[model samples]
Target: DASAMDKKQKQFDKLINEWKQKCEDITVELEASQKESRHYSTELFKLKTQYEESHEQIEALRKENKNLAEEIKV
Candidate 1:
C-alpha cells in the first residue's frame, strides 16, 4: 500500500510540473504578441499622419494651379 501511494504521489507531481511549464510558455507567447501589436499601432499612427500631410499639400497645389490658370486667361 505504501509503494502504491508513493507512485501516485509521483505521478501527481509530474502532472503539476508539466502544467506549470505549459503555463509559462503561454505567458511568453502572450507577451510577444502584445509587443508586436504595440509596434504595429505605432507604425499605423505614423502612416496616418503622413497621409494627412500629403493630402493637405495636394489641396494646396490644386488651388495654386487654379489661380495660375485664371491669371493666364486675363
Candidate 2:
C-alpha cells in the first residue's frame, strides 16, 4: 500500500509540472501576438493617412485640368 501511494504521488507531481510549463508557454505566445498586433495597427494608420492625402491631391488636379480646358475653349 505504501508503494502504491508513493507511485501515485510521483505521477501527480509530474502532471502538475507539465501543466505549469504549458501555462508559461501560452503566456509567452500571448505577449508576442499582442506586440505584433500593435505594430500592424500603427502601420495601418500610416497607410490610411497617405491614402487620404493622395485622394485630396487627385481631386485638386482634376479641378485644375477642368479650368485649363475651359480657358482653352474660351
What alpha-carbon RMSD in Å does predicted model 2 have with respect to the real structure?
Answer: 1.2
The TM-score, computed over Cα atoms with residue i paired to residue i, of candidate 2 is: 0.88
- Model 2 residue runs over 4 Å out of place are none
The best candidate by TM-score is 1
lDDT minimum window of 10 residues, candidate 2? 4-13
lDDT of each model, Cα atoms only?
1.00, 1.00
lDDT of 1 by residue, 12-36 (tens): 9999999999999999999999999
- The true-versus-predicted C-alpha distance at residue 18 of model 1, in Å, is 0.8
Estimate, for each residue in 1-74, the C-alpha lDDT of model 2 and write its tens digit: 99999999999999999999999999999999999999999999999999999999999999999999999999
What is the lDDT for 13 in model 2? 99
TM-score of each: 0.92, 0.88
Clashing pairs in 2: none
